[model samples]
Target: MAKTIFITGASKGFGRIWAEAFLKRGDRVVATARNTETLKDLVKQYGSTVLALALDVNDRAQCFAAIKKAKEHFGTIDVVINNAGYGLFGSIEETSEKEARDQIETNVFGLLWVTQAALPVMRAQGHGHIVQISSVLGMVTLPVLGLYNASKWAVEGLSETLAAEVKDFGIKVSLVEPNGFSTDWAGPSSLHTQPLDAYNKVKSDFQAGLTDDIFGIPEATTDAILKLVDSANPPLRLFLGKMALPWVTQVYSDRLATWGEWKEVAEKAHGK
Candidate 1:
């Protein structure tokens, strides 16, 4: 069935690609960005199938209004892709309070606001999909993307709780954790602080994807998004890239090791 899909951050990157793909398949897409003007070309190309709207995810009220507008236009939103977030590149110590707050606003609170606004409609409709555009960084931390990691980790936690809470209502939540993609997410779409020299040499080694070299470019992930939303029973967490599982598995393996090492201490917390 053709779906009424609402996508945030539709101006560029994964969001834009997914919007175009959905439109190509004859699905109705409510494409939103801070500047709707960027989508003029998309609307022209897709015709009436695309509804480009101005949306600043940091603004809670604007999120509700956009969802409301989508519901009014398409009757009900069958899918919502919360792809509106940017990376904050800096060490935790070097990151500014304002920068950290801004990251959380868009990556965490912004998603929450959109979900809150859309939940009522889904409950009424009895079925809907909430897709969160998180990152593998959500599961594993890196040197420079501390704030970004924190924001995505929060998304994972809240999204898991949301999935359980809404399952009874027939509403589903999916956390899509794609590794660094070839998207502008690390380029123009991202924000960064003046780097501390202490992090420069080491961070350069880990963040090769930040450069213009061949291995630095991210691969296309639009097909992964298609597969995710098309499934009737999608996973609560879906890793989109080949490297995603390897990276996440390492993190989990270390966690399990630490837990096993402290198993006796952990068991002491349980009632005798």
Candidate 2:
């Protein structure tokens, strides 16, 4: 059965690919970006099947308005992909409070608001899917990507809790944890790097390590997302790309080993 799908950040990157994939599979797509002009070509190509809306997920009013517009156009939104986000790369100490807060606003609160706006419609319909575009950083924290990791970690927790809350209503929540994908995500749109004299020695090495050349293609993530959307029973968390699998596995194993080593002290501190 063809369904109506609404995706955020569909101007480019994984979101764009996801929108196109769904369209190819005969689904109606309500794709949105802050600037709808970027999607003019997509609108021209797909015509009535693709409804392009201008939205900034960070704006609560716009979030609700966008959902309303999508629903008005498609009747119902079968899936909602929260893929509008960016990264902030800098040491925790070097990153200002404003930058950290903005990261949370865009990556965490933005999704929260959009999900909240969509929940009522899904509940009324008694069925829907919410897909969160998280990252491997959600599972493991790297040195300079603290704010980005924190935002994704919040999404992981939120998605888990939401899954339990909405499952009874036939609504499913999923997190897409993709490893570095070749997207403009790491380009000029990325948050400006904050430098501090105290960390100068290690900053260069860290900057080099964070470059985008190491990422794989964005299509890997889009493929995983399509599979999840089409599955009769999709996973709560879908890890994308060959790199994401091993990296996530290793992070979980290492965290488990470290936790086991500290279990005794941790339990005692918790009064267990």
Candidate 3:
């Protein structure tokens, strides 16, 4: 059965590749971006199968409108991929209040708004999938990428709870945690070096190391996404890339170690 997929941030990066991958597999894709004009070529190539919508995920109204439009055009969305997000790199102390709020608004709250709007439609249809394009940062925190990590962690928590809440309704939520992929996600659009004297000693080298331009191709992530979409029973979390596996394993091990070391203190502090 050919399913209809609604993907945000479809103008570029993993979102764009995922859109193409679904289209290639004969699935209808309702691709959205802040600037729909950028998807002109895809729209032309896929014709009616690719319904391109102009959507700013940060805007609640836009998120609602996009969902309604997608439902109208595609009849019912079998999958909703919330892939619209950007990275914010800086020490939490160095990041401005406004910048922090903006990061949460786009990367965290925007995803919430989209999911809120899509859930009703999916529930009505009886079965659907929600795929969150997260990152390995969601599992582990690094030095300068605190803001980005926080956003992804927020998504991870939200998606985990959402999965349980909607499973009875036949809605499946999956988090796609890709390692660094070669995309504009690490380019100029990526927030970096907020210029704090406190961070000067650590900022330059950290920023250089954090650049994701040299990572695996976007196609690899897309392939993982497709497999997840087609699986008989998909996992709640799909960690993509060989490089990502080690980091994820380390994160789990580190967390367990920390918990074990602090177990006595934690129990006492909690009055247990």
* lDDT values for all models: 0.88, 0.89, 0.88
Query: How many residue pairs clash (N, CA or C atoms closer than 3 angstroms) in each of the candidate models, in the order given?
Result: 1, 0, 0
- Candidate 3, residues 33-90, lDDT tens digits: the string is 9898899999889898899999999999999999999999889989999999998878
Name the lDDT of candidate 1: 0.88
How does candidate 3 fare on TM-score? 0.94
For residues 166-238, write the lDDT of model 2, one tens digit per residue. 9999999999888787788878669866688887766688767766555888776666677799887889988
For model 1, the stretches where C-alpha displacement exceeds 4 angstroms are 208-219, 269-271
lDDT of 3 at 45: 92
In candidate 3, stretches whose alpha carbon ends up further than 4 angstroms from where it belongs are 207-214, 270-272
lDDT of 2: 0.89
lDDT of 1 by residue, 1-272 (tens): 89999999988888888899899998999999999999999989989888998999888899999999999988989999999999988888788889989999989999999999999999999999999989888999877888899999999999999999999999999999887666777778889887788878777887664544322233266677788889999999998767778878988999999999999998998969
Better of 1 and 3 by TM-score: 3
Candidate order by lDDT, highest to lowest?
Answer: 2, 3, 1
What TM-score against the true fold does each predicted structure earn? Answer: 0.94, 0.94, 0.94
Q: In model 2, how large is the Cα lDDT of residue 241?
A: 73
* lDDT at position 70, candidate 2: 90
Q: Which pairs clash in model 1?
A: 182-218
